[model samples]
Target: MNDGWISDEEERTPQVTPVYSQTFGRGGGRGRGGYGENRRARGFNSRGNSWRDEGNSGGNTQRDGGNIGGNTWRDGGNSGGNIWRNEGNSGGNTWRDEGNSGGNTWRDGGNSGGNSWRNGDENITTLAVKKNNVGRIIGKGGSKIRDLESESGARIQIGKPSDEDYGMTVEVTLTGSEDCRQTAKRLIEELTDDSAPRSYGGNSNSGNSYNVEEPQEEKPRYIDFAEANRAYEEAQKERWAQLPPLKKNFYIEDPAVAAMLPEEVANFRKVNNNITASYALGQSPENSPIPNPVQTFEQCFSEYPEILTQIYNQSFTKPSPIQSQAWPILLKGLDLIGVAQTGTGKTLAFLLPGLIHTDLQPIPRSQRGGPNVLVLAPTRELALQIEKEVKKYNYRDIKSVCIYGGGSRRDQVNIVKQGVEIIIATPGRLNDLVQAGVIKVASVTYLILDEADRMLDMGFEPQIRKSLLDIRPDRQTVMTSATWPEGVRRLAQSYMKNPIQVYVGSLDLAAVHSVTQRIEMIHEDDKIARLFEFLHDMQPDDKVIVFVGKKARADDISSELSLNGVSCQSIHGDREQCDREQALKDLETGDVRILVATDVASRGLDIMDVTHIFNVDFPRNIEEYVHRVGRTGRAGKTGEAISLFTREDWSQAHELIVILEEANQEVPHELYDMSQRFSAWKEKKNEDRGQGRGGGRGRGGGRGGGRPRW
Candidate 1:
């Protein structure tokens, strides 16, 4: 074994069973061919220590006048008073007489301590392992780490390093001592599908702990970003030079689309661009990711009959693509990375697999730290949404909980200790629990990174990286998002294991399905009335999510809506975590569906069945717009995205339209016209400025030029 975790049983024989016999048929009987004169009837003397021995036969009853060890075998399979009382002794020939059905068994095997650790039936240990790569140490998802931990009753941490660490993560750290670590690692070598050498690193070399910090031989040379990028490119070339080139580039046949790309981008020989992406990855693009052929929302109830019966008969007539791709992979206990738009069942993709895994194989409550399946969403709302959906699937004997920044620490801690089968949470709050020791990530096996795009977004990256490092590298990983930006691409390179990139729709193109998108050009002052018009037309049940720029505006819009008799509430940074949760709860329960909120709620809030999303404050950039409209068109349901752009707002989003164009999506003619008009207006203004400057030149040309808002 790489470490002293587990040893091979074949090499060493187990000791034979020892014998301790206390012979007596105390209460056996007082029978004597009707004469009641059988001296062997040592009955009426009931010591009442019943032991079952399988050697006795022929329904014989012997007390004395017999051997040193006597057993009375009554007829009728020893049912009734002569049946075995209790074999309370430490495992030998254990027999039980419960009602009419009890078997007398000769347990030929010794204590086989290994079998005692088997997690069967409903009791399981939820081991949250840090995900680390294989060939280095622990196999992917800490597969080897998990085995070791389970066998030893020890916890193992497989720390995945941050980008600064260059994708190099640590291996298992055994929670217990040498013996525990030994048993666990031994199991790893034997049980794993992998036959390669197990990774060995640590002070004691027990295949546990990333705690061993090896001294560096020397300081590595550093380079600037551009120079480093160039070196990286050259190094890739040199690496590829040794291997024979693939006959074809990218292994994909869409040459027409390929032809449109830059020569370097489409180069069939360039190691950097020709194709180095994972062979396991399939083409989902950004839009129209692999379609989930399983069942759609409308058909869900019928598809999983067992789930339907167990969980509340929630309607699920159709299954999303993420769900389809993710379910199969999760069932096999393999790690995966799912790339899809927000609200397209990304939560379900990971949560469903985790639920199924837990339900089919239940674990003990104490060991099942919150949940076997841990879901990491980007925001509180999304976590809550996932938690709610998990409840629908609760009939399978699995429970789910949500943890995020805007919630009670005390309550979260209490429930965490109570233990749940699954947890949907944000990185920030979950990290707090981990640091406090109230939570242990070494127990998590199945992990999902929801809204992976947002996690890579600025400010959240540190927490995401830390949380990821805290988890065992041996667990399954599922990352889903509406947009896969460059940052996400780099993240996938480091964490995902031969990932399959599937997109429901390109973030640039598919966000506006079945939704009427109108780019109305108006002045800044006219925007509010425009919103009022839309709200006026909105039906009572059509819950609206109005996005605004300033916190003041969020409140202002909500006030206007309320004044106009539109049931609504406003949420912003100033709101307490409880109020935010309550606001989300209000929206979910249909209490106050028409809500106005700022950007915090926009990123990962999963407000289900939102009929419309009004970009009252159009995103400063196209990417933001992509995320904004993403709130709707979720889970395959069609929704509308309306933007009231004043000249100022329109100027901000014109590039957003251009980005849409680059993605090969259609730009509404109105948006295109608005862009041209704005350009014309700018030119006129510039022409006026040049003329004025010419006039001023005669007097004196000014040094300063006024910058336009656009």
Candidate 2:
């Protein structure tokens, strides 16, 4: 009767007391037939036909001497019915009675003696689980649950779906023995381990559990309009704080020469002299001498009077800003890195310095076999051009030779063996000559790298390094480029002694002011027609240079132009050295009015009287565009540059707009609109990349967007 709540461990063993009664009732009464009874009996009673208790010697039964319900029994008397009694106090256990008319029947209404039901019919447990892990617990088509049931011998019943809005967990009921229930619970715990809530951006902890719900995406924190504007202003201030201070008008002075300039001449110089210069002293004595700059070529030639005659003979009036500043540094035999607008007398800046140094210390016949000065250029055309400038100096005692590839190496060796004081050559051919023992740099005192950035871009760094290995360590190194990129800066730090940097205008990549740019958005198919139309409007005397993207295109365009009655000549890398030289010569002379070429002619090609440049195909980069436009406006002459762009050039529209705006050129409306579109696309691309999506447009890749080279 004490079955209120019994634990499995506590129900293993129980105690019971036997009872004998004739009729059971819900009352406490004593009778003669009762074998065992208590005054306060709160136990079970079973209904039966009859039961008798006698004081027999063989059976263990107790007889009460009290009457109950007016019934009595005699002691030591045997009844006509069968009587059964379990030995030792086991009589109160579950008893099965076999009647003559039927099978055995178990009556548990009597005292069960604290014995538990071993059939496991009452063992049931319910567990709450995360809804996300219910699928894993149930598995594919209930396979996992069936396997779990078979392994643990437990029947699992999953309850109704969870109400996610209220954060209700799933209910799962398990019915089995203690061991089976414990095993099933452990398996479910392993399955639902990853369902626990995790902090944002934290890694999952459960091993190979895929039933966890994806974490909700956090909303982006957007700043208000006022806050965004404040942040932008602060960022602008920080950026400006990091920039170097601007340099003002501080021209070098030369006291020996005096020349009174007309108002027009002075005005011209002032309008064009937008040069910026910075000087850093190399490892030298505290009192190391520095030379003063000059205002005019006459002042620059005051110390070297012989150079004045050469300058006058060449019809040179005055020095450009770069030459005006660079002349003094180079004359003092200090290292210099000159950056100036293309066609702004950069060739003469270093040339005059080298020539003056040569004039000051004339190399003897014995010391002349090896050149005292070595000038390395990036391309053969540039090297040849430098050689031509050297010739214009007309140094009688200072002999110089120009050597490069795509020409006769044996002939160059013969020239080198004949003896020269200055050797102007490209890096590859010069390195080859030096390795062949035909050229020696041990006696070289001056080293100049013209278009140094272009040389590095053309993969000539190794050759430049090899040429420098045998050169004298105390040599004065000079590097000159129209645009000074970071690579050029690093090159200077590695090779030059604390060098002086001389720049004209801002030291940023931009087109020259003298050249007027006209950009047209046209289709590729219409380019030829546009070129013809442009040529028709051009003057006959105006020498024009047309730039194309590839060598084959150069040839094709040149042929088409020639067929259209526009006398033209093409030159590229694939042309023979003699043919290419002739083509350039024909263009320089009046033999051909138009010259079509690739980027090969972008740098160091100084043809006189060039009035216009046509970009039949746009250059690969802004720098190349600057250099190409620079081909026309030479020697301070104003010129025009016209470029045709297509859809392929969209990626470069933003940069092109910036260049035009910086140079004060009129930007076309189409270009500005395309640039805006490009900006939006760039922003979207960056956002995608930040969200773990793939990015676009790697550096120096893709069509029309690769690194521009000459």
Point to the candidate with the largest lDDT. Answer: 2
lDDT of 1 by residue, 456-547 (tens): 67457777666666455445667776666778777776666656654554444344444556556566788888888887787877988888
TM-score of each: 0.53, 0.60
1-710 in candidate 2: lDDT tens per residue? 23422224223634223254232322123343233321111222232121223322222221122112111111222332222222112223322222122211222222323211122234667788877778877777787788778777887878765576465687788866779998898877766777454222111332433444658779998869998899987886675444322221122345442233444334533565665555643444456533444667766666566778888898878887888778877876778888876788888888877765554454454643467778889988989888888887787668888999989988888878888878999988888988888886776777888988899889998888887775655668899987777788888988888788877787778888889999998887999899889888988789999898999989988888777777889999999999989998998888998888999999989999999999989888888999999998888788999999887787789889888999899998888777777777667656655775465555543443322111
Best by TM-score: 2
Candidate 1 regions exceeding 4 Å error are 1-305, 308-312, 360-371, 507-509, 563-566, 603-609, 650-670, 673-710
Off by over 4 Å in 2: 1-272, 280-290, 692-710
Clashes of each: 62, 1
Error of 1 at 99 (Å): 99
Candidate 2 local lDDT, residue 366 = 68
Q: Pairing residues by index, what is the TM-score of model 2? A: 0.60
